[model samples]
Target: MSSSEVECGPSFPELIRRKRDGGQLSKQEIGAFMRGITSGSIQEGQIGAMLMAIWQKGMVAEETVALTQEMMHSGEVLQWPKAWDGLVVDKHSTGGVGDKISLSLAPALAACGVKVPMISGRGLAHTGGTLDKLESIPGFTVTQPVEKIRQILEDVGCCIVGQTETLVPADRVMYALRDATSTVDSLPLITGSILSKKGAEGLNALVLDVKFGKAALYKDLDSARGLAQSMVTVGNGMGIRTGAVLSRMDAPIGRMVGNTLEVCEALECLKGQGPDDLEELVKSLGGYLLWMSGRTASLEQGQEALAKVLHNGAALQKFEAMLQAQGVSADIARSLCSSQCDYFLHLKPAEHKTELTAQSDGTVVDIDGMVLAQVLHALGAGRTKAGEPINHSVGAELLVILGQKVKKGEPWLRIHYDSPAPNAKQHSDLQAALLVGKADSYLASPRVAEFILPPKM
Candidate 1:
């Protein structure tokens, strides 16, 4: 049939069958199909079917690359001048609850002389997006024109823009279809969508934070490692120096979870006093990025340099500078926090009163990440659908971490919510997600995960 006769260029059923049967598609065919979907020429149902097929059969590296290029071409690619060059380093994280490390890491890296053009997103599942947390700061604008992004990067050494419709528009369409069809769990599709946006931005080096746990989307070490490897491979293939770091999500990253509250916690990290896990993750990722960018010779050197930036208070200054460059009013920073309370600057009161304590008082063993996230979501810290406003005051502030001793009457964690609706929903869910066992129930960490480097082409 002629191109004109085929409405979306290729029949949806035919393309779905081709991929489902492990057949390869030429770049043009895949591009045409994605273009049709994003342009509304193809029905959402057809697009959904294609997503499911791709998820099940998987895409070859070539197909994944083609898909990435097509999605990137579906939107505008950002441009920057050579004079603004200082190795631009940025980071991406797989979705997980309490994954707010980027909020502090970006500024800390920028303070160390790297230009960070950080594009962030909002909450998708249980984990919150960097843009959403930054939005909690009054009047901070995540939306900026491409030129404005470059300008802010040039002047302040950093900028965090929201995922825009004008950039990677095809991925935008595909992501929604995948979410609707339950095909989002596929590793190939996930890697393509994640890397396409980061690659399209044209950075010198990139760092990926791949998290796995009940609270994380990957859910286990093996799955998370595969994703990390794929992202690094694809990224390096596209000529971007990419490194992946696996992080623990057995519990929340810090003491806070809501937007404003997480922002406060992030501020604490920039000031060099945050949770041990959160700080370690941020420093490790930042160190790798710095090394990839050639700002430092090795991870040890990069960590040493990052430490000086933190110790001298330059990291906090860079963070405030980037916030101002992005149009956050000066008072927004001051009003949200200082050196005092890390939970909330104003100590916003919550109406709910509940705690999940260890009943038997053994070593804290397993905390279901997904269950904890769901409880918080039901309590209104996250959205049930797209465009839903997040309740910045509602989330969990964890007190007891893994392997910590907990007495029977001691509070394990505090649930914060403003009203009756979420209180009734969160209390029971929170209690059930935590499984406390005897001394031998302690979780073990992986001695080593896969290394992510460019293949021997």
Candidate 2:
């Protein structure tokens, strides 16, 4: 038989079987399978089976690169104008509780001369999403057509919007299957999903914040490191400058941990007055991005530049421009920045509330982020499944930080809820999540635990 009559290589099932049996897949096979996924030639069952196979038997670095590259080309790859002078950059975070870094980081970078066309997603499980937070601002839309996105980037130097249907459509299909099949934890699948969307953005450089601890997607440091390394390798292999920061997520980053509350906190950060931990995170990520794009000579210099922009009101101006470009009225945008109280009053209030106090005088050793996130979800701050509506006003606030000494009756946390009263279990869980001990036994957790550099050429 001629080469065309016999078909060139292995069939899709044969490729799946090879991977299932711990055999490596060639680049052509990977491309063929991903093309099948995008064209609907591959059935859902076969896709799920292939994902399970890859999850059980991991792919090597080369294989991962192939998968990432193929998925990236599965749909429209955006082409910016050749005359566009600014460097295009963006950031991604492994989902974490109370992580509003992107909200401020994008505009901050734009203010420093880099264009940030950020593509964001909605909240999943206990973590808050950038799109959800932006949606909290009345008239601030996350969905935009490609031409509008390009126009916003050219006009304001930054634009945060949700992924368009034409961009990385294959990743969307695969991600839904992964979520349903419990295959979301696989490193290769994660790398493919994250980079495919980011790569479609036509980024000049990328910074990743891979968080670990009780509240993060990867709960342990080692696993988080592995994921970070994988993403950095695959990202640079595909010709994008990538760096990863391993941050601690044992407790919420800022004071607030819900939708609207987080937006308020992020706004304060843009104004240069927010929680210390949150500020440190934003500066570190933004600094790396500036360095990667060659805007600064060193990381320290990048950090200093970011600080200057934040203090000189440049960052806030860029943020306001982005909001206005996205359809928010100038008056409402200023009102949101000046007084968030008026905005909160219009939303449904979490009328039923309770304060969690210290049982005895001691220092707070730890606050389990996972537990607090669960409590927030139970209070309707997050969705348990897709398509569920979230109550933006319901959440908890931390009154005490790690290593802070507390009196017996001092409030440690405040739980806000829409229910008449929190049930006994929620009350108990809230109390249990707070671990107080002797002052000498308490040790503060580092905000940025480790930094992973890009792969060496």
Candidate 3:
């Protein structure tokens, strides 16, 4: 059947009913629904119903591929010059707290000779967003026209920006509907939403950082693995080389957990001196992309190359170049890279503060990332809804981390705030989030649990 005929063939209600009853949808049926969505022929109610149905019944691999492809084609699919071949690659992480890998990884990959056009989003719920962190820099902008994005990529080999309204219209509508309908967790829906955007970017290769545990989108390992596998399957099925790594998010990836602070932490990582877990995660994800794009012979080799750029200051230079390309002053970027402490000193300090000291001498067994993120959100570090303002400077800092032994009077967390101090309940909650136990009971968790590659063709 012709594409037009497919759109005219099925009634929207019938399609929803079929999927609701566990019936597999044909490519034409899925394509028709997507077109209806893009054209406004499908009402929001209908979309919500279909999403709920799919959430309940789930979708098969083929159905997911169809949805992703249709969404990718619903708007412009970016195309680079033929001469550039396929040096383009990008990474997407299932949101997590203190997950600022993109800030460093983009420039790191670009320094390794791959072009990175990273389209990021804002913080939703407890997970922090890349665009939010970038905007925390003085005079840095996240919104840009497509021509400008192209220009920045050509000049800097990378640009991290938000999704343009016209880039993938279908996913934009579907994402809002998913957010409203509580269907964000469906494996197929996530696979479609993520790959649709990445596919639309016209990437040569893609890396998926699927995180699980208390602070991540998926709370369990099995579910996170399923989502990762589904995304890889659909992405490769659509011809974009994809790989995934399952990482633990039981604790925040780095020491800082707020906007400006996370950006500062990323700057430290670029200079070869951030938290070990954050640096290692960036290397693992960047190395996979390098290997997938054939920049390195193997993952180990790719990591070695990344390490070279990091230690030799090439990655930091690339990052500064990207910042300047985005309109930050060269002096400011250089100062941020060279002396972050001095750079931070100029920013206004929060008006109120409180410190939480260790109750007894012991080892830090766990710092619940989800609870900490919630506390940060309550303190105005993150947005509870879209378009809300983030405090940027107001957040809690972890003075002690996992497996560290602390004395009774040692401070483990310091809360920075601008207004009234945290009330009694907030104080109790913050204290409960930190777990201290016997020194020998501390068992550190591995950061990278498993590395998954696209299935053999």
Per-model TM values vs. the true structure: 0.89, 0.95, 0.96
> What value does the lDDT take at residue 337 in candidate 1?
41
Model 1, runs deviating above 4 Å: 1-17, 38-46, 84-86, 334-337, 341-353, 421-425, 435-451, 455-457
Once fitted onto the true fold, the runs of candidate 3 whose alpha carbons sit more than 4 angstroms away are 1-6, 339-341, 345-348
Q: What are the per-residue Cα lDDT tens digits for candidate 1 across 85-105?
A: 548778998777777888888
Q: Candidate 3's residue-wise lDDT over 1-457, tens digit each?
A: 3322445676788888889999999998888888888888777898999999999999888999999999999999888867556799999999898999999999999899999999999997898989988887887888888888888888889999988888889988999999999998888998998999999899989999999998888889999998889999899999999999999998888888888778878888998988999988989999998998888889999988888887788999899999899978877877787744565653445677789988888899999999888888887888878989888777777999899999998999988888656878888887888899997788777799999998762
lDDT of each: 0.76, 0.85, 0.87
Over the stretch 374-398, how does candidate 2's per-residue lDDT look in tens digits?
8888878888777788887777789
Q: Which portions of model 2 miss their true places by more than 4 Å? A: 1-7, 83-86, 339-349
Candidate 2: give the clashing pairs: none
Candidate ranking (lDDT, best to worst) = 3, 2, 1
- What value of lDDT does candidate 3 attain over all alpha carbons? 0.87
Q: Which ten residues in a row have the lowest lDDT in candidate 2?
A: 1-10
